[model samples]
Target: MQTQPISTIAFTVFLLLFSPPRAAAVRPPPNPLRSSCAQARYPVLCFQTLSNFSNPTAKPLDLAQAAVRASLVRTRALSAYLGTLKAASQGFGPRQRIAVSDCVQQISDSVSELSKTLNELQHLRDGTFQWQMSNVQTWTSTALTNGDTCISGFNAAATTGNVKLELKQRVTDVAMLTSNALYLINRLADSVTGKSRSNSGN
Candidate 1:
């Protein structure tokens, strides 16, 4: 007979002595929002943002819309903040002022794009699902691109370091939300298309 190591036997005894009941060790029930958010590029942010409105009955399209709405809300708030910065830009260097102004415009554009995406998602029709989903994809992608543009505008050497850092962090947050929205939208489109194909086959 093989002899077990003392440490191994001791560890086994420790487990038996201290481990919780089997029921307590069982995995917790799955969260639908967590499951849905896993499909996004930023799953943690996605879950956090959607948790405010997510329900047990929320479907893929519902989650996508909620994500876009969250992005839109954040973008709009950032746009307002940028407006204040642009107004108080007298203290900034000429290049910094220009960068701030441009960032404001870029964020404004992002707001518009996200608004369109949310609208399209809300009114999605099965008859034109593909066409409408294409529009949503384009708009969401544009929104993300606009945020990137805003961040790039601050890359000039003349930009105020603190302002640049703050704007970058805010824009990055909105961009992550938008990116997660796009991921969910794309997943919704793929799932619908797959089902259509399966139905046709049957």
Candidate 2:
């Protein structure tokens, strides 16, 4: 009998199905702002707009403007990453083929969820910083999966194409965006909660 090789993936999938989803430890929120961050987002285009004619390192006039810039930064990085993935899937070696296919699956899944979260982010900016937080968490996991896929693809192929190299670069870009998004989410939350405390004290 030609039995299938034991795969960590099969085992992991089985374990996930059986085990309970673990929850993160709850923490107090930050941000002293009265308005919510749910609708806060970076620009749909790049960070620059008629309202943002100068350097982004300089202060944005309002919270929404700051958010639009942040979202654009994240979006540009994500677009760059996808470009890399398209490039990496170019080879035909048995190993390379397998590796690239795995990356494609993960990248596809991650992007699908990312799109959903982004749509939600664009809708409102009230008490929904939780959505922003969720986007970060999802992206972090996606990056890990994409990274593993990239390494595996590289190992299987003797030589990489421009495309393959791009995939690796994308993993880098996505990780950067994930980290920055989380920092903003935390800071914004803290500011919100701090303001709430102050008003209560007053």
Candidate 3:
């Protein structure tokens, strides 16, 4: 057998013992927005509406707040548009004018409900978490109901023409946004309840 150099052998052993092990594989962090929207009733719409929302912390409450705020803004805009229709009343029949007036009121109520929801979410506290979440859910649902009422008023009035179509479209859009917001708010409530149960060993 050929003899190997002792120095070379020792150097090889040193390299084996001292070389850094291969770095462990790194994994990307979970996407908060995607995860939040995954279980929503309107996941795609929820994601799109909140895609531009600023949520660096990625907290559930932040997402809920954003959703409610978006609904509130849309409701306010729709209410304003409805007011114009009610005021002009030029082309509208008497029934349509009444429907537009009713819708304006309904949308105004929706705006208030959404505003309340947003406020509750913003001020949510651990001590009153359940109570606050209940209020948020109720208010959000009320807003959605108000939107439905607006549409129903138009239907009952037998409203026709562009005004009817335009009001229905805008109200429907607000209702969808409000519905998504309510869904997210309920999800947040569930998450909180689960955490509470876990902490108490229930």
Candidate 4:
């Protein structure tokens, strides 16, 4: 029996069978505003050595540092729940608003302390500032003030998605400010060290 010539339809079928499957769609990059944040360069200075927050005798630096860390914890907590809240379209009333506002107040107080730390850190330019480490006192005060401002701003905001979005934006700003304060503070301290070394050689 003579073999039938391959038909066009058969050829088309064969080609389709050999073709590779399409790849999954690639995701777009995240929005820049949300993606960017403070460089994770941790601060390495003790404002004041205190046992704990319960001890009112602790130095402001220690107290302030504790406060910032606490605020960050709250941030994490809220971030975790925010997704669920948004998904359910859950509407928080005045009480929740007040709670968030309290958080904002805490942030503001922390920022104030950080700013003060920057100013005091600048004084680290002096060798004498090495001892007592008291120069950073003013800086601690400044940081506390800014921290308070940050917290207060959030608390004062209206209870709306728009307001919440604004609060999120402020978080980024606070992170950036914290990074800057730490960087400048270190630089100021370095300047003092260089001066000390120079004077010793003279």
Top candidate by lDDT: 1
Can you write out model 3's per-residue Cα lDDT over 1-202, one digit (the tens) per residue? 9988999999999999999999999998976787788887788888887887646466777888888888898899998887887789877778777777787888888888888888888888889999988888988898899888888988998877777788788888888888888888988898889998899995
Candidate 4 C-alpha lDDT tens digits along 1-202: 9765679778888989998989989998753211211222432222211122215443333333443444344444444444344344336665555546455445545545554443443333334676524445445435435544544555565445664565566565445434433443344445556777899999
lDDT of each prediction vs. the true structure? 0.88, 0.51, 0.84, 0.46
lDDT per residue for candidate 2 within 1-202, as digits (tens), equals 8766579679878998999889989886643232232233432222223124334233312333343344345545555555564575464666676666666666555555455544544553557655664664465455445556666667667546675676566565554444434444455456666877899999
What TM-score goes with each of the models?
Answer: 0.85, 0.47, 0.82, 0.37
Q: Report how far off residue 198 is in candidate 2 (Å).
A: 3.1
For each predicted model, how many residue pairs clash, with residues at least 3 apart or on different chains?
0, 27, 0, 34
What RMSD does each model have against the real structure? 7.1, 23.3, 4.8, 17.5
Candidate 2: what lDDT?
A: 0.51
Worst 10 residues of 1 by lDDT: 152-161
Q: Give candidate 1's error at residue 18 in angstroms.
A: 25
Model 1 over residues 65-142: C-alpha lDDT tens digits?
A: 888888999999999999999999898888888888898888899889988888888898989999999999999999
**Candidate closer to the true structure by lDDT (higher is better), 2 or 3:** 3
Give the runs in model 4 whose Cα sits over 4 Å from its true position.
1-91, 118-127, 131-160
| Backbone-clash count (model 2) | 27
In terms of lDDT, which candidate is stronger, 1 or 2?
1
Clash-forming residue pairs, model 3:
none
lDDT at position 60, candidate 2:
18
Q: What's the distance in Å from true for residue 60, model 3?
A: 0.5
What ordering of candidates by TM-score runs from best to worst?
A: 1, 3, 2, 4
